[model samples]
Target: MSTLTLEVVAIDDGVPGIRTLTLASPDRAVLPSFTPGSHIVIQCADGANAYSLTGETTSPREYVVSVLECPQGRGGSRWIHRDLTIGSVIVAHRPRSAFAPVLRASRHLLIAAGIGITPMVSHLRSARRWGRDVRLLYVHRKGRGAYVDEIATLTDSASFFTDRTAFVSELSLELASQPFGTHVYVCGPSQFIDDVVTAATALGWPPSRIHVEHFGGDLAPGDPFEVELSCSGDVFTVESGVSLLESLTARGHAIPNLCHQGVCGECRVPVRAGSVVHRDLYLSDDERRDSMMACVSRGSGRLELEL
Candidate 1:
């Protein structure tokens, strides 16, 4: 991915734990345009972190992103909240979209929780401009909604829920009322996504009509395992607290990688033989049969790779 050195133009608190930042070119150049659900990888002091763009898509001059301070996280969010400031220059990759609206759908349903509401902002804006039928269900803590007021202006069909039971009840009703050809987009914690998907499927929503994006959580290291390269005939033992990608790279193996959180499919390699514990959201069933994302996926005892 190409990098752009942009300056933070503005910063404001979206909620107690979330802060919204506006970034622009230093020389006032028109920045690259992005569609709804697009995200850019920001190079932070600790590591690269991806944030969804939540600004105007048409004739965009700046990219707006919201970051939630994760004190217990991998230090990326903490750096953003504590060190990054207005007028500070930061490097970021060009915007890319893995989750986007299906324009052919008759209607749209957006579900978000906590920081996941970032992308919904962009989706709601575009939906309003196109006059598409859209509804938003924003679930957050009582006072932790990031952009509740701004989102309210985009659509009157929006609803907020704080309790888990109430959220599920409303979600079931919402899914049941939607007509055919309605696309559902969900982004949030793992449990939240799983619950929403389970309810949607039980309500007769097909997997094809359901879209999802994971706001990744910290990946705890798995048990130690050994990996053997098929061609090179070299074996390496991956420690219990280390990732397969990190272990390989430390041993001088050049593995292509980005978004180490497994959202981006940059470090996927062919698995000749192994029982892989797949953790990535990028790969499909067919792909998982032979390949694995080296950055996050791990093996049980031994893994033979074609790389």
Candidate 2:
């Protein structure tokens, strides 16, 4: 788990509640390459929170992430909004992927709302660079979209909506009319994602062709549980206040992980035996029967994990 020390080289508060920060190495070194829709976990004053990279993947010099001030959140967005300034340094993990663009699809149908458009910004950048077939449906308040002009400039097949009812009515037509092999992607609030997914499902879109990304939210502690590593025969107790990732890492288990809030699927472990209290947003119902995301998921009684 390597980390980069990044400096807030630039800040754009032009957008009302959204602040876009540009981070780069203090020495001007090139950053790691990332796929479209990738994100980096930044260390905030409260804890580590994942933000989607909005810059094109081709950029090697810096990473960009937009923060929407959340007074009701778990303090990460609040700290970024109120405390960070140009030249302020912070630590962050390298970019990791969970919601990458499906390059092989016949067409990409991107639907986003509010700050969910952050990841779609990168997706559209790559699609333009490669000349992929894509369409964007962005919904936001009349004057509050973070990258409205930029998105309109990037693609001609974009539609904007400020009215929820209008968007919902248009969504059905849009979902019903896409050509074959059009993979649908949705990113936004849980209810918004559910709406898109449900509409697509009703329209006969296959589950495999739909992708989703959930933003970091305050994680509530779960009941204490224990997990046993089958090979090592080591049992670790996960406290109510601590996550399994924290519990295991504290005991010297170097588990590969990203987005400890459980949106990214990097830290999933196979469940050999026992019942799992699946809490992650990444895994589907079928996948949950065999695996568990160690980041936010828990187990009841003694559980065996293929660690």
Candidate 3:
């Protein structure tokens, strides 16, 4: 991906623990055009972090992204919250999207949890411009979500849920009430995304009509496992707390990787043998049959890789 040096034009506290950063070309030139649901990989103090673009895409002059400060995270969010400031120059990759809306759909159903509202905000704007019917359901802890007030001003079709029970009940009804040719877009934590998609599918929504974007991997540690390299016949133990990418790298395996969040497909490796417990969204069903993303995925017992 190509990189661009941009300056932080503005920063604002959207909600508790959420900060919105507006970026633009230092020369005040028109930035590259990006569609709704697109995200850019920003180079942070620790590493590159992918964030969805939440600003206007039509004749765009700037890109806006919201970051939820995670105290226990891998340091990217902490860096953004503490070190990044207005006028600070940063390098970011060009915008890319794997979670865009289906423009041809008759109606759009947007469901977001917490900071996941970032992409939905972009989708709402684009839907208004395209004159497409759209409804938004935003779920977050009371007074804890980002962009609540800004999103509230966008559409009257929006509904906010603070209670998990109420949210699930309402979500089921909403999924059941939508008409034919309606597409659903969901973004949030892994469990939330799974719940939404699973409920939609159980209600007969086709996989093609349900789009999802996972914010990040489940940070909870997993069971320990082993991985064997096919090329070198070397074996390495992947601890319960370490990622496969980190494990391989620690053992002198040079692997090409970009975002450690599993959104980018840069760390994909062929699984020559053994079962893989896939945890990434980058691979398709067919791709999962032969390969897995090393950054977030792991093996059940032992995995043989082409490396």
**Per-candidate RMSD, Å:** 4.1, 5.2, 3.3
Q: In model 2, where is the ten-residue run with the lowest total lDDT?
A: 214-223
- The number of clashing residue pairs in model 2 is 0
Tens-place lDDT per residue, model 2, 1-307, is 4789999999999989999999999998889989998888888886678899988687489899999999998788899999999999999888887788887899999999999999999999989999999999989988888888898888999989999999998999999999999999899876788789889999899988998886676444667888889989998788886888788788887888866777557888899999987656567678888898888888888788888
> Using TM-score as the measure, which candidate wins?
3
Model 1 sits at a Cα RMSD from the real structure of 4.1
Residue 189's lDDT in candidate 2: 79
Q: Mind giving the per-residue lDDT tens digits that candidate 1 earns over 1-307?
A: 3788899999998489898899999997888887788888888876678899999986678999999999998788888899888999999888877677898999999999899999899999999999999999988999998888998898999999899788888888998999889999999886778789899999889988988887755455668999999989999899987899998899798999876876567899899998997767567668899999888889999999997
The C-alpha stretches of model 1 lying farther than 4 A from their native spots are 218-259, 263-266, 270-292, 297-305
lDDT of 3 at 50: 84
Candidate 2 runs further than 4 Å off: 218-260, 263-270, 273-291, 294-307
The lDDT values for all models are 0.86, 0.86, 0.86
The residue-by-residue lDDT of candidate 3 on 1-307, one tens digit each, is: 3888999999998578998999999998888888788888888887778899999887688999999999988788999999988999999888887678887899999999988999999898888777889999989998887777777777778999899999888999999999899999999987788889899999999988988887764444668999899989999889997999998888888889977877668999999999997766557668889998889888899999997
Residue pair clashes in candidate 2? none
Residue 33 shift from truth in candidate 2, angstroms: 1.3
Q: Tell me the spans in candidate 3 whose CA falls farther than 4 Å from its real position.
A: 217-242, 246-252, 263-265, 271-292, 297-305
